[model samples]
Target: MNEVMDVIRLFLPLIVVQLLLMSVALFDLYRRVSVRGQKWVWVIIIIVINLLGPIAYFIFGREKSSEY
Candidate 1:
């Protein structure tokens, strides 16, 4: 139906963007865990805390560059 199609059109973009953001965050978490030897903690955090886990990882979990 036309109404269904309209709803899909509006919702599709938002869904796509949300998926992209989640994927990006998960990918970043994987990279940080792999590189820093912290996979178990990061995996637990990512699964248990969801979006907040990645946000925290981005803020504090990454390995700091010594050059700074």
Candidate 2:
């Protein structure tokens, strides 16, 4: 039990951060008119690929804005 608690404590913050990142990515994806590739695919990547998923979407998925 002690070891389990230790592991959870170590990973809890990372897990929380990961969820936060995924939530932000998903929300951004929803608000945008376009992304680099298919929106559905990016949604899957952001939701299913864990820490790297949202990062990948943010880095590679977002299309350049024309509003600038």
lDDT of each: 0.64, 0.92
* Winning candidate number (lDDT): 2
Tens-digit lDDT track of model 2 for 1-68: 99999999999999999999999999999898888999999999998999999999988998878531
**Each model's Cα RMSD:** 4.5, 1.7
Error of 2 at 41 (Å): 0.2
Q: What TM-score, over all chains together, does every model reach?
A: 0.52, 0.91
lDDT of 1 by residue, 13-59 (tens): 87676556557666776555243547677666655674576666666
Sliding window of 10 residues with minimal summed lDDT for model 1: 30-39
